[model samples]
Target: MEVWLNYVFGLRPRNFWGLVCIPLFPLLHGSYQHLTGNTQAFLLLGWFILMQGIHLFYVVTIATALISGVGAWLFGPPNSVGVGASGVIYGYLGFILMYGIVSGSWIALLLTLIIAVRDAWRITGNKYNESQLLPVERSPRMGWTAHLFGFIGGVLIALALSDMRLN
Candidate 1:
């Protein structure tokens, strides 16, 4: 059942049918490890976003998914089927970090710092042995493309909303 869902819902780059998966990819995971790996970060970051408000939470989530999904679809490795919530996780990371910077919120900044310190190893660790000489030369299984795009989307959304008063 897991494999079947992943097969049907995973993001397929450059395929018209894959477009539908933009909203669905984050809901699917390839394995137990994959799901667990994303769950912690997703919850942590999502909680911070939710602190701002429920409406903003939905906005950040939906926008980040769209931007990250489209970006992965455009630049992801050919024929790769991407799955997992890492993109949204990364999106949350980006949003919180950028929001802290842009909004001058000490709480946001402190939360960002806490997350950075706690996850520093994961953020800096090299998952691939190769130097990744090119942006596209990533492990097809890693969803680095989704991470990158999702981070960008999060930052963009944060910037877009920076002017608003946030809690």
Candidate 2:
């Protein structure tokens, strides 16, 4: 019975909610470039989490993604299409911060501060095109909100699922 299940969904696949939200990404953004950029970052950070352990990684990613995506949809402007794994990335930030706090390790602490600062830097400035303001849909939804909520969801899930120590 267990073997048959593994062949199907590939085991629970952490944060299952997030994976289900991937398709909604196209609805959120109009430009392929914007989507691609977020997707690339998501893939990289996702790998970082995966290295920790498949089950833990999957659970955090999926859970954060779902919570963040739903948050965006609910809190974001009306009629706005929303999608992207940025929230999951944000959730990672949340997890890292809490993980460092819980474990009090230098690596976890430094990594969290470094990543959080770097991302904060990017979203602070507006990327412009010559003289005209671009469509919100075409622009990268680079903001701290996703990371904010991602962190919230991450801490909640991480705490509930297991004791995470970033060693």
Clashes of each: 0, 8
lDDT of 1 by residue, 4-38 (tens): 88888899999987888889998998878778877
Strongest candidate by TM-score: 1
Instruction: List clashing residue pairs in candidate 1.
Output: none
Per-prediction TM-score, please? Answer: 0.88, 0.62
The TM-score that candidate 2 achieves is 0.62
After superposition, the stretches of candidate 2 with alpha carbons farther than 4 Å from their true spots are 1-23, 26-29, 122-147, 159-162
Among all windows of ten consecutive residues in candidate 2, which has the lowest summed lDDT? 129-138
